[model samples]
Target chain A: EAGVVQSPRYKIIEKKQPVAFWCNPISGHNTLYWYLQNLGQGPELLIRYENEEAVDDSQLPKDRFSAERLKGVDSTLKIQPAELGDSAVYLCASSLGLSSDYQETQYFGPGTRLLVL
Target chain B: AQSVTQLDSQVPVFEEAPVELRCNYSSSVSVYLFWYVQYPNQGLQLLLKYLSGSTLVESINGFEAEFNKSQTSFHLRKPSVHISDTAEYFCAVSARGGDDKIIFGKGTRLHILP
Candidate 1:
C-alpha cells in the first residue's frame, strides 16, 4: 500500500503571507495528524483528527494556524499572516482510529518544507 | 503527561561496527515505545515498537531495542551497520490510557564513517 502523501514539497513565502499545506493519508486510515518540526528538534503535534472530527488541537496556534479534514481522507493545514518564526517542516501522519486499535502505527509523508522570510 | 529524552544528539561510527543509541522515557501509566528512522530528506518510518511483549524487539535491518522497565530505557543497538544505516532516529512514547498523544525526543543523528 502507498504511504501517506503530501503536496507542494516546498514553499517559500514572505512574512505575513498566507501559506497552506495538504495531505492525503493511507487508505482505510481514519486518523490524521499535523505536526511541526523545527531544525534540530523533534516533530510536535499541532492537531489530530479522527474521521473529520478534531479530537485534539490543544497544541495548535489558533490565532494563525487552522486545519480541516472535510472528507476524512485528505487534510489541509493553513497559516494566515504567517510570521518569520513559522518557517519549518510540516509533517502529516495517519493511523487506524483509536477505536480500532489499541496502539496503531503511524505512517508519515515526505512533509512540506516551508520557508518564511 | 509523558516525555522522552535522547541523550546523544549525534553519533559517529565506522562502517561494520556496532552502535547504540540511548532513549529514556517517563510516564505514569503503562506505555508504548517506538523507534522511528528518518533518512536524509525522507519521511519517518517505524524502525520497531514495544507494546506488551517480550522486552526485546528487532527490526528487519538488523537493529534491535530492549525495553528495560526498571531503567525506563529503550536503547537501540545494532551489531553491525552499513552506510545505509546513516539517519536520524527518534524515540517516542504514548501512555496506554492517555489521550493517544505521542511525545518525541530531540532525535539522534547517526553518521557512518568509512
Candidate 2:
C-alpha cells in the first residue's frame, strides 16, 4: 500500500515569509499528526487530528503556526512570518486506530525540510 | 507528562558486530514505547514497539528490544548488523491512559562500517 504522502520535499524561504506544507494521509487512516524535527533531534508533535477535529494542539505555536485537516483525509500546516527557528523538517504521520485502548502504529511521510534564512 | 531519552547520540559499529541502542523513559503512568528508524533521505519507520504483552519484541529484520519495567528502559538490539542497518533511530513514549501525546528523544545515529 502507498504510504502517507507529502509535497515539496524541501523548501527554502527568507525570514518573515509565510510557508505552507501539505500532507495526505494513508487511504484508510483516521488519525493524522504533524511533527517538527530539528537537526539532530527527534520529531516533536505539533498537532494531532482525529478526523476533522484537532484534538491536540498545545505544542503548536499559536502566534505563527496553524494547521488544518479538512474532510479528515488531507492536512495543511502553515507558518506565517516564519522565523529562523522554524527551519526544520515537517513530518506528517497517520494512524489507523483512533481508540486509546489500542495503540496503533503510525506511518510517516517523506518530510518536507524547511530552511528559513 | 512523559519523556524519552536516548543516551548515545551516535554509535559506530563494524559490520557483523552486535549492537545495542539504549533508551530510557519517565512517566507517572503506564506507557507504550516505540522505536522508529529513519534511513538517509527517508521518513521514519516503526521498527518495533512495546504495548502490553511479552517484555521482548522483535522486528522482522532481526532487530529486537526488551521492555524492562523496573528499569524503565526499552533498548534496541541486533545480533549482527549489516551496512544496510545504518540509520537514525528514535525512541518515543506515550502514556497509556493519558491524552495520547507522544514524546520523542533526540535520535541516535547508527553507523555501520564495513
Candidate 3:
C-alpha cells in the first residue's frame, strides 16, 4: 500500500505572506495529525483530526494558523501573515485509530519545508 | 505535562559495533514510549515502541529497546550496527489513558564511521 503523501515538498515565501501545505493520509486511516518541526528540534503537534472533526487543536496558533480535513482523507494546513519564526518543516501523519494499542504507531509524510524570509 | 529526553545529541560508532541510545521520559500517568528514525530528506519512521507486556521490544532490523520503570528510561540498543544505520533518532512518549498526543525529544544523530 502507498504511504502518506504530501504536496509541494518545499516552499519559500516572504514574511507577512500566506502559505499553505497539503497532505493525503494513508488509506483506511482514521486519525490525522499536523506537526511543526524546527531545525535541530523534534516535531510538535499542531493539530489533530478524527475523521472530519478536529478533535484537538489547542497547540495550533489560532491567530495565524488554520487547518482542515475534508472528507477525512485529505488535509490542508494554512499559515496567514507568515513570520520568520514560522519557518519550519510542516509534517503530516496518520494512524489507524486512537485506541491505546493503535496510538503506538503512526506513518509520516515527507513533510513540507517552509522558509519565511 | 509529558516530556521526552534523548541524552545524546550524536553518537559515533564503527561498523559492526554495539550501540546504545539513551532515552528518558517524564509523565505523571502511565505512558507509552516510541523510537523513530529519519533518513536524509525523508520523513520519520517508527523504529519500535513499548506499550505494555514485556518491558523489551525489538525492531526487525536488529534494534532493541528495554523499558525500565525504575529508571524511567527506555533505551535503544543494537548488537551490531551497519553503515546504513546513520540517521536521526527521536524518542517520544504519550500518556496511556489520556489524549493521544505525542511529545518528542530533541533527537540523536547516529554517525557510523567506516
Model 3 misses residue B52 by how many Å?
A: 0.4
Let me know the DockQ for model 2: 0.66
1 or 2, which is superior by DockQ?
Answer: 2
lDDT per residue (tens digit) for residues B11-83 in model 2: 9999999999999999889999999999998899999999898999999999999999999999999999999
DockQ of 3: 0.64
Against the true two-chain complex, what DockQ does each candidate achieve?
0.60, 0.66, 0.64
Return the TM-score for each candidate structure: 0.97, 0.97, 0.97
Q: Write the per-residue lDDT of candidate 3 for residues B60-109, one digit (tens) a residue.
A: 99999999988999999999999999999999998887875899999999
Candidate 2, after superposition: displacement of residue A90 in Å? 0.4
Candidate 2: residue pairs that collide? none
Candidate 3 positional error at B113, Å: 0.1
Whole-model lDDT for model 3 versus the true structure?
Answer: 0.92
Q: In model 2, which runs have C-alpha deviations exceeding 4 angstroms? A: none
What is candidate 2's lDDT per residue for A5-85, written digit by digit as tens? Answer: 999899999999999999999998989999999988999999988898998999999999999987999999999999999
Residues A27-66 of candidate 3 have per-residue lDDT tens digits of 9988899999999999999998889989889999999999
Per-candidate local distance difference test: 0.93, 0.93, 0.92
